[model samples]
Target: MRRFLIDAIVYVRDLALGFSRGWSRFFFLPADPTPLGLIRALVGVLGFWSLFVIGLDLHDYLGSQGWSDAAGAYDAMPPFGWSLWFYVPDSLLRVAWLASLAVFASMAVGLFSRTTSILAWIVIVSTVRRIPIALFGFDQILSTMALYVAVSGASGRAVSLDRLLKRWREARRNAAVVRPKGARKVSPDGPGRPEPSVGANIGLRLLQLHLAFIYGMAGLAKLRGPSWWTGMALWGTMNAGEFAWLDFTWLAAWPMVLNLLTHGSLALEIVYPILIWFRLTRPLMIAGAVALHLGIAVMSPGLAEFGVAMIVANVAFVSGTWLRSLVAGRDDEQPALRVLYDGACPRCRASMALATAADPDRVVEPIDLTAIDVKTIHPSLTAEACLRSMHVVSRSGKVESGYDAVTRIGSRLPLFRPLALLGRLPGVVQAGRVAYNRIASSRPRDAVCTDETCGIHPPVSVTGAASRTRDSSAI
Candidate 1:
């Protein structure tokens, strides 16, 4: 019995330890602050728009003797509800409102980001609490994001004026640092760039959890209604005069289609919270959300802004890596190493994909030699040279070829770095170059080799077929 009791205690302790470790990893792990910055930029626009609209009729709504007095409106709210307008005199109301706009604009641009974020939160809550009668889901989401955005400096760390200023400063500071001649001026990913932060992860996790709870609760509430179960819920929404913009009355003729739409939406909402956590399903769910909210924006004029707010809130789940890929072409995009390779070689294409699939920062940009004229792109590149050897172009104009190119590209990717190191070994590099040349020279130069015509390439170099197989793993 004593041994049994000790075993039970040990098991409980182990279980608790596992739970604590998992929880800490889930929330406290450092993450890129880009998503928070994105959320802040979007929420700032919504807040500024709401405030601008309110500014149009300030006296009629939020003034001391407006339709709803601050005291009466705020009193109905939960305890400790407050508004800056309550203390501001009527004569100075316009001035205070303008100042609030400036604060929101600062938040939007990410100037002194954390300070502006906190101020924006206070402004949103204060105004909303002061005029509770005009509240909507849009207001609620705006307030929610405002609070979360204030939780860390993440809201301004990227996609902000602050980042731009930091870059400008770094450029000036590093102006004297010598760079490779004829090389592209690439900034190293060390300082003056968005670094992963634990606070950013905390802020994003809080928003994600809150958003999932909201969606889950909404789905649960819909299940309580017979209209949703019978697939008539969307029908009611489409028929509503206040919400409907376009004529969805024609949906009456196509009951099956209406049922599909209603049922599909219901299922997606019900499963979104549960399935969105998985990497495999997250993209699909996020896309589904975008479609659903876009439909709401188009169909319902009154809820358009609310739908937009929900979509913006969903941005919290998007990863920094995906975000970088989305902006890959921009002038201010992160520095990337370009791989110039033969498009017709399926093996080479597959090899490049394998090497780059795990890249977190989207640094590898593959340029197919067939698709673009190499002579026009760079002076060192020629059709014959590219055909004879694989080429990698640095961010600066420097070029690496054959075995050197493979190592250069591989070294930059985390998983492939060891392969890069192995290739650079004393004997390995010389043998690799010989095998690479043999493989490259064997390919059909006149016609594109289809998969069936591929295997005929001669392994007749000094390295022989076995060495050819070993060294020709990638282009």
Candidate 2:
């Protein structure tokens, strides 16, 4: 028992280290101590907890009663029962249940993430307490996970409004300061400078440890069971018609196949932790786990949902480095093109800058037409033509003007790959380019607005000419 516990601790420690390494690389954080790394850890911990709460609610909803009966029970639960703090009416309970679902949904989107996480925990706990008889071990696990999420800051990245607000604030600060002539300008850093809290790191480490414990306990439980040791559990479960609601009934008809699947299932389950422990076999083990869950879903009527939840949770096991590399590879493929753009035209310059920023390896270069030598690169394209719209010189030295340039640039970036592909389709590219040209040409020559703030520009007609001129000057 002591040996098993020690092995479990070592395995979990390695997994945590893997997670830390992957996330640190993904966010481009410095090794050892980093604010971004700490944030990543916090977010991961919160995500795990959020998923746990969601899984518990789902399990409770599905486990106790049939679909129709559960619906009736949902309706029957008091809105504000005596068990609740305020002696809330029975209708309030129903509302709280619905609210819990909404909170979970919000958490998934990172909207009011912290508040939603808390609400989800409260609702889940209340619902579970209201009907203790119907709860399962999984439900308890989920509740505990939600509690963890409520205390951690997990939704601090791509999915959340919090990150967007932080970015906006940073941009505002950058714009507020005017650099003096000949003065060294300090670049405005990205997002909030939230200090890394040790509590957050400890919380995340605890959750990872708990997950390892769950796996170890599950393995131990299976070892102690007779059907698992004898290889009959899987066969019997698969062949049982009462549980088999899907097309897996065919397995019932084949004795040899059933026996093979049964033995395979037991062998795999017993050795799953071993495979997960070894870095080389981890992928195979994960794939097998997915297959196992999928099989469970197909063979057993209700067991499939639990299998699905487990599969979702397994995603946490994927190294952050692998995920980052996948995204980075796509970013690198975006068209390697240089655009000679007018930096003085705020809107034009902003778009070019954004494109270049999105693909930082100089995959897309936005050269200031006035500041750089555009004539040397493309003798055919006149400076007047380049000034009229965006001009892109492809990786092969082929020059495309206006909308064609945009499409060419888009094709090279990972995030815009779909748009690039669509640009190549019949008529679509021409139409898009034409539309872009019309919009660009109609804008005031002095207009300075980034894509995000460009809509503030008024019509170029004389009616609002004075105001538009003032706005352009201010920009």
Candidate 3:
């Protein structure tokens, strides 16, 4: 048992490393495109805004009465009588409520990210404390988590007006430092010297650790539950009349099927941590989680909102690299020869280098055909043939070669959407592959172009001449 536990810990650690490495390669290492950056900005804004609204509601609920008073008031009211709580507000409470909303909105837009985050946390905590008895588990979880995240400083990466202002200030400072040819020499460590922000890094690490702990705790909680032990809890919950949005009454007639589903849910909940911990099993585990959430949504009406939210949160389980690939484009669009080269090259390292240089956020993995163990990862690739050209293996295990691999990689790039589409035309794919092969053959095996030369350049034309330049340089 001890050995098994040790193995599990090691497996999870490796999985996490791989997941983080993949994301770094895709999103951070590569040159990020404007649109992808915008999407991230939007997601961040929306996430923070949602927290703000929730905080406002909590503030309103708390200001009218104390926790004990609220509980007594709730007992006096009939079921669904809590609607009355929204209308009545104390004078001092009304001011605080409005202030909380304003702060939340400011934080959402990232006006002064660090400052707004701190204020938002204070407002949320105050609200939670005021009406603790009225708060549901989900409400408490969301508010507490938001407070934690706000203080931890997630708004730093998310596109915000504050970041734009900071950039403008820095640019001005840089311009001011520039001098005419005869000006005195500046010291090496001048006033404008860039320093690393340890605060940002520390905050990011804290958020990652907190998210991991949440997952661990949730898994452990399920293990201690009676439903998980008996394999009947999930079934009962699903079949309960209160949650029946869909007519799953038909499913109840099938006892064997119900038993299977019940057992599967129990097993999945119990083993989720272990599965997520393993590199080989992480993808499967994520898929299972999605399915589980979908099931909860279909059978339960009120639960769909919670289920979807949880599923979105579980997105942390997915490698950033994989998420970027899915959002960027489909895999069928790659050039052939580039795919071959990718497969023949080293695993994660070379691909990651290219990805990080191209776009920091949407990095895709390149296949490594050189390893003797490549067959285990990709059974279809024969060791002898994989060496002949550049190859790329998609997540689904489909292989592309030469220019096709370039096209595939390009397709995953937000900036290269038009070129990727053009590459898919019948004769264009073959022509591109032939051109890529010639270029690959000309370059010496030991020579490698820097990212400046080999990375995809900004769009030149719909004809894909710019991509061709980068593809040729990769050889």
Candidate 4:
């Protein structure tokens, strides 16, 4: 009995620890600020658009002579919230409206980003509170996005004046400082700013989780309505004169298609909250969300704004690295042959020099593993693995190592293409791999094994000696 109780206690403790670790990783894992920055920029644009929409009727809605006077606006406020428009005079209200526009502009450009974000949130809340009837999910989503962007450190990363200015300053700094002999050139912008708080991660996690909750609740609400289950909900939704853009009464002609869409939408919404949490199912669920939202935007007329707002919000849940690469236009261009080599290896350095000299146009990009952080560029390739063997990352994002990497590089150059082609023929390929393995195994270990900097200060004589020694090894 004693032994069983002890084992049970240990099991419970282990389970608790596992749960706690998982919770921490889910909510507080460090993230690149890129996604958060994208959210900030998008929310800024939407906030400005919302303000512009309100500006057209600013006088009609908030002016003293208009529908809601100051006193009437004050009375309309909910018991829990406040509105600046209520207490201010008509002229002050106009000034506030203009000031809100300025705040939105600043937030959009990421000038004083966090501060502007706070001001933007206040402007949104105050204006919406004054006109509670105007409030919708768009307002709520904007406010929520603003709240998180204000808390996060995403303001200075990219597509912002702040980032540009930082880059300019770093460029000037790099120019002023004279680097030591054989010093590895650091990125002009230097190391990334360490996140003071896990706010970016927490904010993104909250966006993802809250969106899931919203989808789940929406699905449950649809279950309560008879039309949804009958697959006729879309019929009513489309036929409503106020919400329908076109005469969707014609949709009655295709009952089967309408029913499939209605039922399929509900099924996706219900399953999304559960499936989005896992790695494998996440892409599928996100794609489904994009389709669902885009369909609503395209097929349903009046709800396009709502659908688009949801789609933009969904951007927060996407992986930052993937988004960054996409934004960098890696997908649009032809792939380059990225040569990943150990800088400390004399033969490797000599080979890189030879390749570059052979092709002055610079098609092959040499990546010194000693200088670059592989994690940022290619998360899958670790420094230890790169140190062990040469790696060739093809433009198509495929990784080739050992003799295959050599052949890939050689095939890309005009001078060596024939030799590379010959090396690939049947039994010749096997012999090349064997020779490559022996050469790799016999190469001396560089300072990269101990300290990454050791490769940067190789003896001058070593370069010449390594070039001569390389005649014996396969290039």
> Which candidate achieves the best lDDT against the true structure?
1
Q: Model 4 over residues 1-475: C-alpha lDDT tens digits?
A: 9999999999999999999999998878777666677777777888888888888998777666666666777776678878766666777876888888888888887777778888888887887777766667778777777777776655545445565455444433332222333222212343322232377787787888888988999999999999998998888877777776767788799999889989989998999899988899988888888998887776665566677778877877787656644423233443367788765554676566555433313356677676677766576888767776788887778898889999888776555779999999999999999998777655653332333523222333333322232222222
C-alpha lDDT score of every prediction, in listed order:
0.74, 0.54, 0.50, 0.69
What candidate 2 gets wrong by more than 4 Å, as runs, is 1-88, 93-98, 131-145, 168-188, 191-204, 239-243, 253-256, 267-278, 330-342, 348-371, 374-386, 390-431, 445-475
Score every model by TM-score. Answer: 0.69, 0.62, 0.47, 0.66
Models ranked on lDDT? 1, 4, 2, 3
- Candidate 2, TM-score vs. the true structure? 0.62
Judged by lDDT relative to the true structure, which candidate is superior, 1 or 2?
1
**Considering lDDT, which of the candidate structures 2 and 4 is the better prediction for this target?**
4
Model 2 clash number: 15
Off by over 4 Å in 1: 1-4, 176-193, 329-377, 380-475
Per-residue CA lDDT of model 3 for 231-312, tens digit only, reads 5666677768877866666765676777677677656665766666678987776677778778887888566645554554
Lowest summed lDDT window (length 10), candidate 1: 463-472
Candidate 1 lDDT, 1-475, residue by residue in tens: 9999999999999999999999999999998988888899888888888899899999887798888976677577778768877888899999989988998998888788889999999999888878888888889988988899998667777767776555544432332122333111222234433788888898899999988888888888999999889887889888898889898999899888778878888888899999889999999988988888888888897788888999998999998756755644233444457777764453555455454443435566666676577876678887767756678887778889987898887777654678889999999999999987777767433234433433334333222221222222222
Q: For every candidate structure, what is the RMSD over all alpha carbons to the true structure, in angstroms?
A: 15.6, 9.4, 15.7, 14.2
Off by over 4 Å in 4: 1-12, 64-69, 180-187, 191-197, 329-475
- Judged by lDDT against the true structure, how good is candidate 1? 0.74
Q: Global lDDT for candidate 4?
A: 0.69
